[model samples]
Target: MSKKKIKADSTIGLTLKTMVISPIALAYLVYSIFQSQIQSFDSISTSLLLIDSGIVTALQLLLFTKSAKKVSLTMLGILQYISPTISLIGGVFLYHEVLTNAHFIAFVFIWCALAVYTISSITKWRQEQMKNEINMEA
Candidate 1:
């Protein structure tokens, strides 16, 4: 097979692993939450937080895995990181979680990296589309 085909196959293999793991992780997360609640480490109100967290994780992973199948794992990893980073920022700013300079810097770096990736992907995609149009015209 050609080199491009081989490389594409590698990505396909990675995609399959991610697709399988995502649901498994989500299920395990929900099970752990329920188990903890049953163990009486908390009451109904506190348990509800765990249940809500599990539901949110399952849903987030469901959405993330979809995009992960399209993008490279490195990019997907950064995307995953950003969601929690944003959540942290929200907790800090809105709920006054004792924001720190170090934490703010960390989030800034994450945002910068994601911004770089997004810009590069957009440019590369536009170039590919233009190339395709040119080929069609040819």
Candidate 2:
């Protein structure tokens, strides 16, 4: 699709998402008001958090979806691992979170799954290349 078309589609999608979610948000806001769950809104930190979680997060997701469309499926699959992996590393090193035995086992399993996927993908690609070569020779 053309850039203009893609932009238009993204805008429409974002609008539709907001339209669908707005009512639920309004309901929650009302509930919070009646329940006195909302504290002072006068704080700059609170305002910044609201903006970051609502607007910034939506824009980031929109951008991510748009960018993901431009990459190949295999590359996208591998790229999906990056964020969680980074978070896990950060929790272990930066936060000094202890990696328990279960966490270590799960992490190993996930890496093993990724390794199997990568190897299979490479093997498939090589097979396809050989098939094409044989067809050319024939």
Candidate 3:
């Protein structure tokens, strides 16, 4: 399908999902308000922070879905770590968070797994390309 069609389809699906979920979400918000569970914002800054977070989350999802179509599934899976890895680095350096032995071991194992996956994907892709070339030559 064309990119335009795919985008239109995604928008339609998003709209349908929002239509179904929005009412339920609104009901929950109403119930929370009735139960006095909804707290008033202490400052405009806090409300702005909440709105900013929502906007960032929505943009992340939108961009992720848009780029997902242009890459292989394996690449997409590998790319999923970019955000968390940045967060981990930020926590360790900027936030002065400590990584325990367990965290180190987990990171080592994850890197090993990713390395294996990437190597195998590259080998498979090369084999497929060679096969196609051979077929074209024949």
Candidate 4:
């Protein structure tokens, strides 16, 4: 019933919906193609994956921006940077791909930049929340 609880529930709902959206879309696409016998693996190229993922990334950011009251775009930027850095590292290790020291160092630099952004966003959001609380009390 409380405002915080309502916000939390809304965020949870948004997250679940976002998680399900991609799978449901893929399922639908597969179903639509069920009648076709011919299939080409070339349709699933790297550029296609990048474009699809970019669209999803944009959608998630837009969703979070439209849904969350406190979080800023900067925070999302930081998370986006850090998360993919980690994912890339995992991909290299898991897929047994070639990863040089230069790649690791670049990731570290990106991570550091993201850390600064994360701290700034958190501090900014906290200050705003405190001000809101003070205003509510007055």
Candidate 5:
């Protein structure tokens, strides 16, 4: 159960799922269109927007699957915070959104937790390195 093999297996599973699901999804969309449930794509912009979103979603899934193979589940869970953190920053700065006091407190807590987790991981890695060095010397 090498990492590469695991990644490949997961990728194959994803592809299989996509194969099984995409046709049904496409059929539903087509049915909706035939039933006049899908109203108007009055402009090229709307079609392009849908295409752009589909591309983004596909890329995100591909990258997530690839990275999941190389990282510990704990680290993966920690890294998942990045998307929400970025969204929060975008909302605050780009969209001029305000954070409540509770939101600020939560952000601080998240940062502190990340710091502690990082320090612990580094310390464990250092101890492992030291043991390897001693074993080599012996």
Candidate 6:
């Protein structure tokens, strides 16, 4: 399909998704306001926070859905690490927060696990593709 058509479809999908979800989200927000500790914030601050969070969430959802449509599921899963990786970098470099040995070890382990998982997934996909090709030939 043409890139223009894909872009239009993705935009429409995002709008529809937002429209369908907004009511449920608003209901939950109202429930939280009554049931949770929302009164701690004065009206102005609470309203600003609500608006900021809503905008951030909507942007994240839009970006995530658009990228997800364009990328393989495996790549999308791997991309989930970007936020944490950014946090890690920011803590170490920008904020000058100390990365303790345990945290460093944990970070290493997580990346190692992700690498192993990615390799295994790619191998499995390749094998499946080979099998499909063989079947097609037969």
Best by lDDT: 5
Off by over 4 Å in 5: 1-10, 19-40
Clashes of 5: 0
Candidates 2 and 3, the one with greater TM-score: 2
Residues 1-138 of candidate 6: C-alpha lDDT, one tens digit per residue: 533236565667778878998899889878887887567456888778878997998788777667677786667778889899999999999999999999999999999999999899989989999999999999
Model 4 RMSD to the real structure? 10.5
Which is better, 2 or 4, measured by lDDT? Answer: 2
How does model 2 fare in lDDT? 0.83
> Can you write out model 3's per-residue Cα lDDT over 1-138, one digit (the tens) per residue?
433336555556556767898899889988987888977555788878987987787677667667667886777789878788899999999999999999989988998999998899899999999999999999
Q: Which candidate should be chosen as best, given TM-score against the real structure?
A: 2
State, as a TM-score between 0 and 1, how close model 6 is to the true structure.
Answer: 0.57
Compared with the true structure, what per-residue lDDT tens digits does model 4 show for residues 26-135? Answer: 78768756857435434779657767886887677657555444554454445556567677868887888787899878877877876786688789989999999999
TM-score of each: 0.51, 0.79, 0.73, 0.43, 0.72, 0.57
> Residue-pair clashes per candidate, as listed?
0, 0, 0, 0, 0, 0
lDDT of 6 at 34: 87
Residue 135 in candidate 2 has what lDDT? 100
Model 2 alpha-carbon drift over 4 Å, by segment = 1-8
Ranking according to lDDT, highest score first: 5, 2, 6, 3, 1, 4
Give the runs in model 4 whose Cα sits over 4 Å from its true position.
1-72
Q: lDDT of each model, Cα atoms only?
A: 0.71, 0.83, 0.79, 0.68, 0.84, 0.82
Least lDDT summed over 10 consecutive residues: which range in candidate 5? Answer: 1-10
Give the per-residue lDDT digits (tens) of candidate 5, residues 91-111: 999999999999999999998
Candidate 1, residue 70: the lDDT equals: 68
For candidate 2, the TM-score is: 0.79
